[model samples]
Target: MTHPDTRRPSSLTAKLAGLACLLTLAPLQANDRLGPINITAAREAPAIAPAMPETVITREEIERSQARSITDLLAGRAGLTVSNEGGPGKLSSVSIWGQSANRTAVFLDGVRIGSVSAGQSYLEHIPLEQIERIEIVRGPRSGQWGADAGGGVIQIFTREGTEDGSHLSGGIGAGSRSQREADAHIGARQGAFDYSLGVAHRETDGFDACENGGPYTPPCYADEPDNDGYQRDSLQLQAGYRFGEGGHVRVHVLAASAEVEYDGPTNNSEIEQRTIGLSASTGRIGFWQLRTRAGRHIDDQDYFRDRHFDSRFDTQRDTLSLANDFFLGPSTTLTLGADQTDDKLSSTTDYVEDARRNRGLFAQINTRLGERLDVQAALRRDFNEQFGTANTGSLDLAYRLDDAWTLTAGHGTSFNVPSFNLLYYPPYCIVPGLCFATANPDLEPERTRTSRAGVTWTRGPWAIEATAFRSSADDLISSPPPSYVPENVSEATIRGAELAAGWTTDKWSARTSLTYLSTESEATGEPLPKQPRWSGRLTVDRQLGAFSLGTTLRGRSGSENDNQGYVVADLRGSYRVAPDWRIEARVDNVFDRDYEVVDGFYQAPRGVFVSLRYGR
Candidate 1:
């Protein structure tokens, strides 16, 4: 089926030039130092130790960068390899330490937020207008989070209303590929209650499609549609209330819907998705703290092939979790938690409908040995009706060498269960009833063991960190011959190193990171496919009175499978047009470098956008 073209036009290059001119005419100012929040610390203590290899992107940085999505915001972090399977709102994935994208966990306000259908998170669905800040913790976190925590975690915190007053803000912008967006936010505080609401709408035309494995020569998919893009709408609301002395409670609700169209070799495909969630939490009672949360997630997909061949799939998940934190002594803290999940799937195909239930319990302890040393240990047991029971654990130690340096080490174990789609996808063949793919009910869960050592230093206005890590996985899942069964011959060993540095002075600030990774299949001794050996980024920001300017350079090395490397540049600036009004603009892909993260997918071309914001 063919759909009408409705994408807006992109103007990224023009806006970028305008911002550069504005910067030359204005004087720049210095940036201020914002104190860091130690996320790894369980409780307040003297001499808070930093979480090594962690990256923080503050509100100021977010505004200065003019990022449209979470993927754009995290593009520069060390040890992260991001790729989009299809352009824009399609499917995007990130790999850390040469691990698969499914190995990483994504959290919103400390709650896991990934789909059970593909075992992947859609970073683009997160509206940037609602974000307060993002915290990235690199390396294994199985002790803290469960399951897919082997590749690290990304936690997103939404904005909370301030106690001082109420405010309203809104903005509109347009960019390349006929992209347009509008966002608004309102926040207020009354008595003991504070609340915030946010909404955003985004639409884009996207780039032309190119057929896979065909000649790169012109006149190929050239006649195909140019600007076949996507649209998304999202809404978020949060409220918190503080009790007189020792209690506080909060509630959050979020909803989003999206529609996308793509060009294929013989036909075009359209996709739509909707998500809704609600959660509540409370705090404080003597030396004990209690928290509970329940949420539901749903996803539906429809694929239109020929008139006679269409497929649809629906997946839903329900989760309930509880946790308690208690102080055992002056030097030790203990945390206990339990979780239960129910997943249901329905498909239009002849595949069997299935329901999977999982229950887990975990405990963690944090202890301080002395003024200069700290240690943490945790254990978890998970029982899934389909896969039986699995156990995981982690141990971490941190030592302070001096006021400016710290040394840290950690070891963790994690696992991944096969998704329903992977185990039940039916086989099909060129012939009417011939078969090509079959299901295997005896598949085993993949297990991984990870270890890392790192060091960090903070001196003057400069901060630097370096880490090295190794991981091995057993019972690794892969697609093998005849019956498409999950085989045990897919084990892999991966090792990598990452380094990052940041410097901030009065009017100027800069940050950069470099990562190198190597992976090999233990069974066949061949390098893993799709992972690049090197990736790095450099960003610089400068502020001048009413005008601010920023630039970024991102680079990726050639992959092990004949993929070429590319470097892209971005420019952004904002001007205070009035006391309550500001104008912002950005240009991305300055050189329009042709690059692809996946084998056949094409990346977006150079784009530009200008926006205006008003607030009280």
Candidate 2:
């Protein structure tokens, strides 16, 4: 079921492959006008340049795409892949550099949010409407994020009040499959305090997500053809107070609940997520600046089958962190931080352990030379009640090749412990007293080491970047066929190349990306399953007065499952009717390409959506 590379490239070829990127980077030069500020790489620093490869999805881009969810917006990006089982609000996951979704850590307003029991984040539960911006850092980031960052990090920031005057905004929309949605938001800032609140609700009667039944094919459902439906409600509130000098305190609360109907005995499921965080940053005390934060996250889910209640899983996490940044010299800074978190789970199924705690400390240093060079290094150690201890580190470097070109490279290590379900789930018998299997409490943490190098050229309204990356992980936990017992593999390696280009003109703008990936398992000499070898995207948008028109083409060369290439196109148009009124519409899957992201699960069919907005 897995695809493996038969021929492995030499190490010299790998190094040369990265170096060859320099030649394709047209006029090697650097430009800073279009660089966006990012904070996820270092946690507390606003840096235009980080040693890692990263991307930012701004509010403007979000609005331009008119995307329905976070997964829709992120699916075609470089170094990323998304897989969905059913339709909207169903189980969805994001994979980075060919790694599993659970290996990637997700955060909201700098606070980690997910289920500790499953070791995975529910991307479908997150509302795209409440987000102000999103930062994605690709590669191992556990040195700064503590743990579960073997693949990468995704940080979503909520909308905030930025002006002194109060304003109200809202929208209503209708789409294919009887989908309807409405949302409202209000915000204001006065003196040292500012606050914003928003709420949204959406529901839809979706399409049949499974294939029809036949002699050769399995039944979609035991009874009849059914449409999987979904509904969601979300609320968000954030407040901040600025005091003396550069000191401020902020609080954030976000909650969302969803109910999704799917095929199978368990016809439907419900999920709820809530996160609350409080953080404060103090003015510089001499050469040191201090900050502290405390947060809590709750994840609850329930299942229903054949009109009967099945089970429930509820998990809670509490976290606290403190950090300090010291100005070491004119061009140097050092950061030290400590973090603690406790995870507790309540479930219908009994397990040996239902609670676990982790504590960690980390340090980083950033320095720059007279010109043309910058460096950052970070290290961290974590102690877990169930897994003993682990350590991770990263180093990144950037060199200015010329006025318009910059060369960057980075190396990092990360580790993730097994989920509680894999570790201590009760043994199950297959035939009463015939066969049985027990959970593996002795499972070890998965360890990964990754490296990347690239050449970036930025000038005027044009920017081009290309990078090559390789990641290898040891102790990859998997449950093979037949016995399906969890065990660790010797190693798994992933190699890929990513290219992105952007251009802007007075009336039109365009962006394009291409990715090539290969994965191999050392133990089996086979490639990992379900990872596409090639993917690409092209987006073009035109602006005319109050009218905007855009189109996006996404193509994926399917992997082991489909083994075929498919392309889907989307079209969007928006018109500002008045100063405070606007109308928008989008048609996704314009070509209606029949594609399957997961075997036996059909992708969303062609759909049209229209919306009206006011006071934005």
Instruction: Report the C-alpha lDDT of model 2 over 1-616, residue by residue, as the tens digit.
Output: 0000001111111111122222222111122122544678767653334545777777778888899988888876787878666678766778888887778999899889888777878788788888988888888889889788988999999989878989888899999999999999998999999999999999999877766553223323233367888999999999999987568999999999988887654567788899999999896777888889899999988877755887788899899999988877877878899999999999887878999999999998888876878888889999999888999999888898887888989999999998887788665432245433535788899999999998877778888888899999999876654455677888999999887777777787777767778988898776666567776677789999999999977666666444455667899999999999999999999978776666655678999999998876
Once fitted onto the true fold, the runs of candidate 2 whose alpha carbons sit more than 4 angstroms away are: 1-34, 46-51, 212-224, 426-439, 561-564
- Per-structure clash totals for the candidates: 13, 8
lDDT per model vs. reference: 0.67, 0.78
Q: What TM-score would you give candidate 1 relative to the actual structure?
A: 0.87
Best by lDDT: 2
Tens digits of per-residue lDDT, candidate 1, 1-616, equal 1111111111111011111211110011111111464453331112233354566667667777888877777763687888664476755667678877777877676556665655656676677787877766667776566677778777777777874689998899898888899999999999888998989899898775443333222112223445557788888788888774345677776666776655532233434333334444345456677766666656665654332335666667677777787767787778888988788777666546478888989888877787878787878999889788989988878788998888989888998887654566565332355434544556778899999998877778777777889999987765443344545546899898877677878787877767777888888686665566766777888989989899887766656542466667888898999999999999988888776555445677788999998873
TM-score of each model, paired residue for residue: 0.87, 0.91
Q: Residue 546 of model 1: what lDDT? A: 88
Q: What is the lDDT of residue 515 in candidate 1?
A: 76
